[model samples]
Target: MSRAQEHPAPDPAELGLTSDCGSCFGLCCVALPFAASSDFAVDKEAGRPCRNLQDDFRCGIHADLRQRGFSGCTVFDCFGAGQKVSQVTFGGQDWRRAPGTAREMFEAFPVMRQLHELLWYLAEALALPDARPVHAGLRGALDATERLTRGTAQELAALDMPAHRGEVNALLLRTSELVRAEVPGKKKDRRGADLFGARLKGAALRGANLRGACLIAADLQGADLRSADLIGADLRDADLRGADLTGSIFLTQSQLNAAKGDAATRLPAALSRPAHW
Candidate 1:
């Protein structure tokens, strides 16, 4: 990891981790590939623009994506990588205006997305009072990752993403341990478990480690998930109705957007309730 000078930690709110499509150049619509799954209506190869994308780089069915068989688009979050690439990395020169750079730009989008995602997690870790012991490490990782986001397209496309992600994941895991330890009793260790269609409604999963768990379509209604580590958990179609996720760590908006929830589902202060829920 790159060493950064000691400074105040980056505020998660100020990092622009949320997607701003208006400032973007339809990168997600063009750079990403989607299959004819329940999430997408049709297949689209990488570097190909979605049919719904407009000349002005706006989604033609943005407000009605879920109703239009493009439910996957609603859950996809670039973590502000789109605008960062369009405006900063590429200096606001869009792919249409500079076709020569389009391929490199497309390749760099995913890489930048990963870096931004790590920044989001690190920033969240820094805010946890129980994770104070590892705040220094978290801040350093956040700084390093943010710097990586500003690299040229060539540098980003050639980055060793897995190695960097592993390093940041270690720090996040340590932070999770510190925070979850505050919860009494033996916490569940369900990391990377395959819990597809699980009937875990009302399960007591407080302080549980659920990192990278495949929870697709699981019946998780009314589950108590306070203080649980949910980094990288696939929650697509998972039932979150009446679930209390009040202090859940690493739960992103995109994850919630993918799940089935209701007005009764409690969330952390950092996340908002999805409209479709």
Candidate 2:
């Protein structure tokens, strides 16, 4: 089977609260640049491996990252971006083996990282029952994003990422506005509501609590889900083309498999699409 076929892409549904890191190659520890802060306690440059990264590409302090002053590592989620770049885009070759490919690989890493971030948000947008009015648009956006993720290295390299990001940002802003506009009072609980197949075009859902909600087949085009809590939500076949999910919480693999997200849809850490798709 082709690589893509070998990795059954995850659906953004059936999120039973589990993190899936099977698709990753520990790229975040090596490919990303970090500065010492509350999140991370050291300084590292892009393309340089983290001091805590083990030979097998796992974290040497995996069990005690936070205590070891790598708290940021614990919170940082690549949304499967590392795996896609390491295994799919580079055809399973690492920077060490293909030393010449390092520059390109490093360059592509951040681009894919941003796209995966968007997928996470789109997944969360589809789970909100209140944003049921724009489901169709959301699905369309999801498909578009998926295609972008599968583009060739040259395509990704040449991409005007800022322009593309701007387009997605517009949609996420709208999603946030729509979702939060309806609450009569500031203190409303819309957690775990069933919003399968709802239309939520251009909705804004920032900082919303949607834990354990059912959002299968929902439309979430151009939705904003920044900082939303989406633990254990179902998102099977939901649309999320132009959604933004940056800083969203607790998203998992089971949720992604149930939903229909594309390259443009941002995703959280720990999950990735099947390379074949």
Candidate 3:
């Protein structure tokens, strides 16, 4: 059966205007592994079911994961990857029915998740009034990322995600530099500056405007971003292992959805970590 028939049509609100997690097979919880931590407090391997996941694949502690000591569950967002992989990509062939497909499905989940995340950002960039100058480029990139998501299972399975991510990184970097350039004293203003690969461990950026900053590969292990404006920051490969982004304004879902960070990565209450991360 096709995904549409098996999973049913998605509601806009559930998908977060991009991808929905409810229409998924709990792919993130099943396909990805997690270790014991203050966030999770348990160890699970890839393709294994999370202890909190019930027989129907719903989180057993859905209503009280935080109070139940599974604080990690409170901060996870799949960016719609779970539904895309379970329904559209695999055509609703679940792991239980086709156990042999588990490995491939697990591998494909993260790959497609990253592509969908890029789509999210590209879509957001197009909607930005200040990013008018880069609209054409953003649209082009968005189209390319969207097309990539439509690749066949074989093609997606063999994709070199790191390399593809690098290509997209370049375009995102250009967009950031172009948009932030319009601000006065662009060089002097650290707000929204490209800090890719810069060593900023333990640095202070309280109340600073970091909108559209490119933080790819930057060392932000303990930097403070509280109350900072992180509207369009590029955090791909950025080491925000312990960086705090509480109260940051204009920090969109697409930004966190695309970036790579761990449980130690502190986020605004509005956003959460990707379940598969």
Candidate 4:
């Protein structure tokens, strides 16, 4: 039996890594900046609320985000950072009501997002039975990252993000190696390859190390992507119809959202099928 079968998959909701927009204070709408591109219809600066952000902190164009030329908003996932900052970091304070806290809250949102992203990856790593050798270290990193997320706004602002991310990245890389090692025979090492718009339909990419690969608009229709390490890979507009990603590691909802997939595409258990597919 494969190492992944050694243990049952953990509940992704238990990790608190999924976005809950209702609990958020529209932090992503205000904290993040977007330029006028194919993704965004208008340019929005940081710390400024999007025009579509309603008074109740919900997106006015949520249902029609893609049709309204705000497809960028549809693909963006804060990994539950919005609710964490709104409810925990600021203690349920709404930036609209507590205008004084707006600046700091905006600053803390992105920082918390990064930390929470690390927590998400670390949690997934712990679920991998093949990565059992580093499970203890992964737990420590997860705990540390969660603690960082709970820090004060000032603490988050003063954080050295590069250093912290680097430390966590090292552990994640080790976990990836341990888990991906289970794949027999030769494995593809296409880490960071720029395959933008490459026509690779029906590719035999099982157990491929595609970390950080630029696969923007690549034709991956019906590809076998099981057991691949897709952490940080740019999958924007990549066709994934009928592709199998059953055991892919480090693939996030944001990546899936950015890609093109149909019902026939097999995703990991934790991820959902993107509505845009």
Task: Report the lDDT of model 2 for residue 222.
Answer: 73
Q: Rank by TM-score, descending?
A: 1, 4, 3, 2
Predicted structure with the largest lDDT when compared to the true one: 1
lDDT of 2: 0.67
Comparison by lDDT, 2 against 3, better one: 3
Q: Pairing residues by index, what is the TM-score of model 1? A: 0.96
Better of 1 and 4 by TM-score: 1
In order, the Cα lDDT scores of the candidates are 0.93, 0.67, 0.68, 0.90
Model 4 pairs in collision? none
The total of clashing pairs for model 4 equals: 0
- What value does the lDDT take at residue 257 in candidate 4? 95
**Over 4 Å off, model 4:** 1-11
**Candidate 2: tens digits of C-alpha lDDT, residues 59-169:** 778888767777556545566777788777899887777788888888887888777766666655655545456544555566677678788777889988888767765
Model 3 lDDT at residue 239: 75
Score residue 140 of candidate 4 by CA lDDT: 84
Clashes of each: 0, 75, 2, 0
- Model 3 over residues 1-277: C-alpha lDDT tens digits? 9433553322324433355656777787887888887657788998788888866668888888756767656555666777877887888888777888888888898888878766655654554455566666666776677677767678898888888777765665555555445544423246568688889888786656676788877887878766555655776656777888875555765566555567887887756676535
Query: Which of the predicted structures, 1 or 4, would earn the higher lDDT when compared with the native?
Result: 1
Please list all clashing residue pairs in model 3, or write none if there are none: 15-20, 75-273
Q: Write one digit per residue (lDDT tens) for candidate 1, span 66-112.
A: 89999999899999999999999999999998899899989999999
Please list the residue runs of candidate 2 whose C-alpha ends up more than 4 Å from where it truly belongs after superposition: 1-10, 13-22, 185-277
- The residue pairs that clash in candidate 1, if any, are none
Q: lDDT tens digits, residues 1-277, model 4?
A: 8545664444557667788999999999999999999899999999999999999998998889899999999889898999989999999989888899999999999999899888888888888878888877777888788788889999999999999999999989998888778988788999999999998899989899999999999999999999999999999999999999999999999999999999999999988898779
The local distance difference test score of model 1 is 0.93
- TM per prediction: 0.96, 0.61, 0.66, 0.94
- How close to the true structure is residue 79 of candidate 4, measured as C-alpha lDDT? 85
